[model samples]
Target: MKYNFDEINNRLGTYCTQWDYIEDRFGEKDLLPFSISDTDFKIPKPISKTIQKVSQSELYGYTRWNHEDFKGSIAQFYKRRHDCEMNLDWIVYSPSVMYSVSLLIRLLSKPKDKVVTLNPMYDSFFTVIQDNDRQLESHYLQAQNGTYEINFSLLEKQLKDATIFLLCSPHNPTGRIWTYEEMEKIISICKKYGVKIISDEIHMDIKLKENKHIPLLSFLDIYDELYTASSCSKTFNVPGLIGSYAILPNSQVKDEFLHMTRKVDFLNSPSIFGMYATMVGYTECDDYIDQMNDYIRKNMEYVQQFLFENLPDFHFSMPDGTYLGWIDARNVPFTSEQIQDAFVHVGKVAIMKGETYGKAGEKYLRLNCGCPKAKLEDGLQRMKKAMDWLYNNQKGGGPKE
Candidate 1:
């Protein structure tokens, strides 16, 4: 309770994409953005203090990627928080999880090889696959009353021809934490068909329930066809820090990733401040996560209540993990573009259009609820106004301007 989550910090002049570039990004001058994944709250005090102390020394030299403190801190964090044991040798530094995923795709598969993933996944995976000249294939996750389930039969069929499977643990947009049984089936299917597995566990630390986040690395004993990329960025609200690490247990695959990395000179040196931030986050900010989870739970409750009371036509399930709220607005009788326009032009608020995730996400909106309660309330009011306008204008009941 020592850290205050209710206070709103001014982010206007800092060139923050969330606050300052709303007009440029969404084509509106007064729209409030609830789209991006990063939180509006300030980071833990320890992180800022560490960075400040390091920066005051002004020793911005090239940071070594093989530092023991960095690896040890990450290892100990996994042990303490997730009860997962990880050897320091299994870890390798990268600029970011996305960067590591791109390299892994290239290393594990060739051009034109099909990479399969679940629909409504992290949007970046589509770009990474296409930009690397690989075929992007997806199977939709079945939604029943707002919860999502995987179609194992279709997944197995896809794995028959797939070269790699990209998985989002505590999945984005939907925020369903994959259970052990589900992960086991996925691993078995991939193992049967010789498909390499790449798991993105960046949001593993942010969960609502106990034992919800089953670390993919913990399954290494049963399945060796796995690789994981995670970071402290999402955990500590420091995406701009630009640092992540990859866990590859297989020696050959690890060497291949390293070879590709060195050939292109990708991730050759570490970020000076990013390294400090990661070390401090893992070592000194353990209790900070517990506090963050409590604040996030309250934010989630606020959104749920606001939608139930004011926008009953919209349906959203409370996510088991992550700070995002996936709202199903299919009953609104409008296309995704129309709904987005309403959110932008009518409501003066911005949220992520569902189509960005994939076809399955059409007519849906992803709301980032990681902001102050007052700001979230304002956004809810704006959305209600837009929805009211839509209903009245369509029914010939709204006031004419």
Candidate 2:
């Protein structure tokens, strides 16, 4: 079926965190926003149909997520897409991927134990670790030729006594998918240090061009203490449905994890909508995913071209995966604070600052190219307008602060 990715849907007044609630993050309103991770695209019809069907029934009730329809569908997806064999029993549902990570941080490590992950990671990784009283350790990734490489020497140092090696596959902010050999090296290091692996593969399905996402599960033979937290929400743009799962390999730990979900977290049952959404997403939405990715890659190319042609000071390289464009504006001759302020106050636009991810991201900004082409163009125009004004300011002949 042909998907209408060009169709623009008005998200204003929807109480969405990406559009309606930017005041809390950007400290302003009525701006064209590319801040939040979720996209503006509509959910796939198959998933939405099930959502509507459940809504019309007026029979919303506790739904079990351990059924074959849920786990079997997920297992089938991995086997079909990535050639990864997953045992249905290893799947355990959670409210969301980050929630699963939070639960696992507590499950695997004690308070103040170090958890090492890449620098400039998803902002929540910083919070989830600190919030759980786990010491957060940073290992900076080396970016070369528009792609990022993990610094194994420093990573191994940080992993010495670290309890958890929290990894972001098809990483956020910068969309480089780790290759199989790199994954093997990471697994080897973790094995040497006895660091429990918790990989967040939430963006696993957003493969751009020919890049393939190798699941952390692929390293099972090399390391058995691996736990991967992922969800169909990112793939199907249904994060609001609030459901995710963790692939736990160890039987004892998996049982304990399920027990915690049922007994302590009190998520004994999952959201009916979330359960159906996952099942349909994994089964019926493969074609939709392919088309959406094509649209996203086109948008990414457009962003790169726009920045090169119009905003020459800013640089963007087509990422290996994900719908976000990481714009490097280090040569723009302005601090991220100045640029961000100009974007909101002068240009009336909101894009996430690089610093929000980590200190290393201070000269960069993340743009969400996940919306319709028209919306993305408008956003880029607003951003360019802001940058133009900043450039003019240095000449002492533009809009003042």
Candidate 3:
């Protein structure tokens, strides 16, 4: 099936966080937004069709998450796409992966227990840990030639004191997919320290060329403490559906985890449409994913070339997976806040500042390139305009405060 990935979907009036909430959040109206991780493209037609069919039933009611269809679809997707098999019995449905992470942290450790992860991570990981009263520790990933790698020595030291290690595979913001060798080292270190691993592989399906998403489950044989959370929300662009799942082997840990999920009333029930959408998304939409990855790869390349040629002060690395581009703006003669203000006020564009990710993201900003080529080009042009304004300000007198 030919997927129309280039189709532009106007999200105005849709209450989209990426599009509609920009003005309210940033105090700038009519600005082009490339901030959030959500894609501007439409979900797969087959998945949408399934959602519509479910909606037409008008019988939305209590639904069970342990059905064969849901489990089978998830199992087949992992086994077929990534060459990893997840037994249906090991799957547990959750409202969202973030919720699962929060609950997992609560179940796995006591308050004030250290939760370690990489710096320049998804902000929500920090939020979840702090919200649950856990001490958050970061092992910074070294940026080598614009790409990122784990500083395993630092990680090992941190893991010695930590109780849980939260990992973002095919990491967020920078989008560095850990190699098998890297994964082995991480697993070995965590195993040595007896720190439980919570792997978030939500962006696993967004692989670019020559890069494959390796599920943490592939190492499950060697390490049983690893728990993985993933969802169709990212792959199928259905986050609003509020569906995600965790994969665990049939063991005592799985038993404890499931028991805690019920005891705490976390993700007690499943969404009626969310369940159907997830099943359909995992079973179908394989080709759509391929086409989406290709389009996003082109967008990444286009923005990389555009920034190099037009906005030379901006530094960006091509991501291995995901639609987000982590850009370094330290060379630009402006603070991160000033750069953000210039983009909104001068260039009429809105993007995520690096500060939100942590101190490691000081002069960086994350840009979403999942939209059509025209929109991506327009955003690049706006970025160029912003850079030009900064340049003119620098040359004429001084940068505007």
lDDT of every predicted structure (CA atoms): 0.86, 0.88, 0.86
Extract clashing residue pairs from model 1. none
Q: Write the per-residue lDDT of candidate 1 for residues 1-401, one digit (tens) a residue.
A: 27787889888888888888888768877678897788888888999998899889988887887868999999999989888898898899888899989988988999999999989988998999999999999989998876899999988988899999999998998988898899899998998999999999998888875537888888888878789999999888898877899998888888887776767666668888888889999998977788888888888888888898888878877888998889998887766776677777788899988888998898888999888888899999999888787777765533343
How should the candidates be ordered by TM-score, best one leading? Answer: 2, 3, 1
Q: Cα miss at 96, model 2 (Å)?
A: 0.8
Indicate which candidate wins on TM-score: 2
After superposition, the stretches of candidate 3 with alpha carbons farther than 4 Å from their true spots are 395-401
- In candidate 3 the C-alpha lDDT for residue 320 amounts to 90
| TM-score of every candidate | 0.96, 0.97, 0.96
| Backbone clash count, each prediction separately | 0, 0, 0
Worst 10 residues of 3 by lDDT: 392-401
Model 2, span 322-376: residue lDDT tens: 8878888888887788888889988889999999989768789999888999999
Cα deviation of 234, candidate 2, in Å: 1.1
Q: Which ten residues in a row have the lowest lDDT in candidate 1?
A: 392-401
